[model samples]
Target: MLSIKVLGSGCANCKRLETRVRKVCADNDLDATIEKVTDYQDIMRWPILSTPGLVINETLVSQGRIPAEAEIARLLKS
Candidate 1:
């Protein structure tokens, strides 16, 4: 199973990103554990300059924007 993290401060964009991530996982039937990293210190562990970061299996794959569902699905597959 994959380990995913959605890092942000509970903002709208962050929620959207989390929703999309969950949707992608459900649509693709991907086995994964999704978590939300809201604390600044915890979020900073990843090299993200902005909110709404997406981490897959401990790798930061995106930041500052909500990626498309297709792109998210692709990220999970890789």
Candidate 2:
């Protein structure tokens, strides 16, 4: 199963990102655990300074803004 973490400070973009992550996992038929990191200190633990960071299985895959669906799918496949 894939482990996904959406790191942000509970902004509108953060919520949207989380939603997209869930949809992607479902649409792709992937077994994933998606979690939202809303705490500032928790978000800071990663090497991302931007909101809406994407961490897949503890690896920082993307950050700053929302990513393309194809990009996400490709990431999951790898």
Candidate 3:
């Protein structure tokens, strides 16, 4: 299974990103576990310097902004 991590501090953007990620996973029938990382230290562990980051199986994929659904689906598929 894929491991997906969303790093944020429980902000609105973070919540929105999580919602989008969940929808993308469901719509694409992706078999992945989604985890929310709110701790600053954990977020910093990744190569992300911004909130609302997306990490897939330990690979940092996106940060700072929400990605398009298509892009997210592609990431999840990979």
**Winner by TM-score:** 1
Window of ten residues with lowest summed lDDT in model 2: 68-77
**TM-scores for every predicted model:** 0.98, 0.95, 0.96
Q: Please, what are the lDDT tens digits per residue for candidate 2 over residues 6-30?
A: 9998889989889888888889999
Model 3 TM-score, all chains together:
0.96
> Each candidate: what lDDT?
0.95, 0.90, 0.93
Report the number of the highest-lDDT candidate. 1
Candidate 1 lDDT over 1-78, as tens digits, reads 999999999999999999999999999999999999999999999999998999999999999999999999999998
Higher-ranked by lDDT: 1 or 2: 1
Error of 1 at 67 (Å): 0.4
Cα displacement (Å) at residue 38, model 2? 0.6
Once fitted onto the true fold, the runs of candidate 1 whose alpha carbons sit more than 4 angstroms away are none
Pull out the clashing pairs in model 1: none
